[model samples]
Target: MYQPDVFAFPEEGQSGPSLLPPPGVLSLWRVDVARHCGQAARVAPGILDAGELDRAAHLVVDADRECYVASHVALRILLGARLGVAPGAVPLTREPCPSCGGPHGRPATGGGVHFSLSHTRGVALLAFADVPVGVDVELLPKTGVVSEIAGQLHPAESRELAELPEELRPAAFGRVWTRKEAYLKGEGIGLADGLAAEHVGTGPRPGPGPAGWTITDVRVPTGYAAAVAVRAAGQPAARDGDRRR
Candidate 1:
């Protein structure tokens, strides 16, 4: 098994172990990056780049602003801990797109380590590994919203959802959405590739990844759905519908 612990961020002023996971293993960190007075000191200093600050400033909702700033600050702190650098000094950039060579692609760091981040409301998930990785955390949608979007997913996935009981389909759709987004984010194509482009099965557990990748559900707090996708390093595909850590 990879690192067994899915750690919460250290409380303010507390120190902890290196945040990097073992090679072929992923370290997933759960952070409560909400906006509040007590959390401000730790958060403000970690807002390293002007771009982030500007983006955060443009978020009109108080909660949206809070999630953007605090989660990004948390990302830098975790990356700094892993790399032995000051949070502000971490080399953060974007990789070129694999398909169009566009400047916007996967967010990246200069060193070999790979990571991905996703946040919903007050919480964020940070994933780290030696190989390319992507993760997503989402608030479960309402039953009606799930029904409306179900038709846009892969045909097989829609059929699977159609077979599920009405009340169950929302959670089921959340799983499928998280899985698909995780894989697309890892591939650096994102929604530009379209939702119907990939078939991540709609089931109690995740299905197999597209070639050269592995997808699995991430066990998160109730009322949310989460998943992670990792690029293969010539290793056998991860066992699906079982690996939760």
Candidate 2:
């Protein structure tokens, strides 16, 4: 099994949490956006940058806006604490798309810290590393969506899911989805690049990622699945003994 260093943020009125994962180490954090919704209403006014605030404003759904603001604010707070900069002043930008040259790809920064964020329902996940990192979290599939999209996965993954007991396929599909998305996100390309091209296995352990990239499953709350990917020279060893609280 893969284990990542996880962190819990301090209460809203308290000082921001400080996280400093060692170089080459990937740190993953899971935030319950619903728990921080109230704090977002208060802290977002000052903590979020103009761009983030504007984006939050454009979200029509109240929960969506709250999740967006809370996640972005949490990200800024973590990044700012790590870089010793004001959260509101953290310089954030998105790399141009490799296919169309549009500024809509992976979020990036110049401080030598790479990160990726993803959220589904009320939960959000963030990942940080010295090298490119990508993270994805998904709620358990409750409908036919998994089966509908199974064909989009790698051929082997498709077959794996096809053979699983009907009751177990959703979790298996979620695992495969998060693993594939994590790898693609780490590559600086999102789902726009397509999912069928890469084949992360459907088993509990992640399959090989593209060259120079390592993918690992992240333990998350029940009813959800998450994974993280990092660019590395070689595969990362399972942290069975290094699991941290």
Candidate 3:
């Protein structure tokens, strides 16, 4: 069984088994880097010059931005390994969505692989598939203010949140939010299309249509909530989707 509880940091030059997907099906790994650019450079080569990495590290290494940058670095590394391409050759630049020009963007090899990146706390999680996909994580302590933002949730999610008692609200809120965000990210719709949480029991929701999605709960530590959304449409082929910059 794949065990998140058993996770150990990779030693220099060695990699760990993926926690997000079944063993051997996906290659997910984590690394703690001192700065954003070095992390990025480690995951995707040449995407940052030495100077750029140093500067980005200085700008984003703090607690607030570390998670997002770490997620980017994790994805860069995964794709580089799976595709047998140079990390820099994977196209890590941030670009506006072609459909909505929103901040939602992703790295692409133009080789047919869809992936998503997310981080909370110091750990970054990345998901890659043969179909469009997205992944998200919520660091629990930071998610407490979610009630104020609860109105932003899809109507169904709001109702569900209302049912949860005050104490359990935070976990429930994070679960739905991550689920919706992951689904939208898989669709390449970003938040512009708006996300909704439709609960069909407490497990993975398979898509309703040809272009719908498949969402899976990511088993992780107690202090966090996570989910992975993968497109259900067409044959699963490699395609990159939205990723945090």
lDDT of 2 by residue, 1-245 (tens): 45544434456622457547677667787777788778766878878878778998999998788778778877888888777777777889888765567998679876568889988768888898887788998888953888899888778888999998888988998898998788778766677656777678888888775656778888888898888888774534222232111
Full-model lDDT for every candidate: 0.75, 0.76, 0.54
Task: Name the lDDT of candidate 1.
Answer: 0.75
Off by over 4 Å in 1: 1-16, 35-42, 234-245
Off by over 4 Å in 2: 1-15, 233-245
Query: How many backbone clashes are present in model 1?
Result: 0
Ranking by TM-score: 2, 1, 3
Query: lDDT tens string, model 1, 1-245?
Result: 12224445456522335535566777887766543323644555554577878887788887777777666766777787877776777789888876578988889997777889898886677888888888998999999898899999998999999999999998899899999999888877787766887678888777765877878888777898888888888543333322221
lDDT of 3: 0.54
Q: Which stretches of candidate 3 lie over 4 Å from their true place?
A: 1-55, 58-61, 64-69, 93-98, 101-104, 141-144, 196-211, 233-245
Predicted structure with the largest lDDT when compared to the true one:
2
Which candidate number would show the highest TM-score if scored against the true structure? 2
